[model samples]
Target: MQKIRYWVVGGEYTSTDFETLIEGTERVVGPFESRSDAERTWRYLSEDHRPQAQVRFTIAQEPQGTMTA
Candidate 1:
C-alpha cells in the first residue's frame, strides 16, 4: 500500500507571471504527514516572503511507494 505525503514547493519567480523560478531561489519545503501541516508551513513561508511580489509557495502531494513496471 502507498501512503500519501505532502510537500511545499515554490520560490521567487522570474516575474509576476510566475512562469519560472529563479535558479538559486528554488525551494522545496518537506514531506509533511498531513495537508494541514503542509498548509501551516506554506502560510509561514508565504508570509515571510510577502514583501517580494514574485515570491510564492504551494502544497504538492505524492504517493510514498515504489512503482512496479
Candidate 2:
C-alpha cells in the first residue's frame, strides 16, 4: 500500500530549510491508490505560488514495512 504525502520546501537554505518541518507549511494530502492520482494531487496543490515565497510540493512514498528515520 502507498499514500500520497505533500511537503513544501521554501525559503533559502542558508536561512531556513525544509528540514524545519513546519506543520503549517509541510502538508500530507492523501492516500491515493494510483501514482497518477498522487501526481495529480501534488500538481493541484502546488499550482498557486506566492511569487516571493520560494515553495515547491514534493511526493514521498511510504515504506512497505517498518522503517526508521
Instruction: Choose the strongest candidate by TM-score.
Output: 1
Kindly give the stretch of ten consecutive residues in candidate 1 with the minimal lDDT sum: 60-69
| Candidate 1 structure quality by residue, lDDT tens digits, 1-69 | 555789999999999999999999999988887899999999999999999999999999975564343
Residue 2 lDDT (model 2): 38
TM-score of each prediction: 0.87, 0.55
lDDT of each: 0.90, 0.53
Could you give candidate 2's per-residue lDDT for residues 12-63 as a string of tens digits? 2222353454445555665566667778877776675435244656666655
At residue 35, what lDDT does model 1 achieve? 95
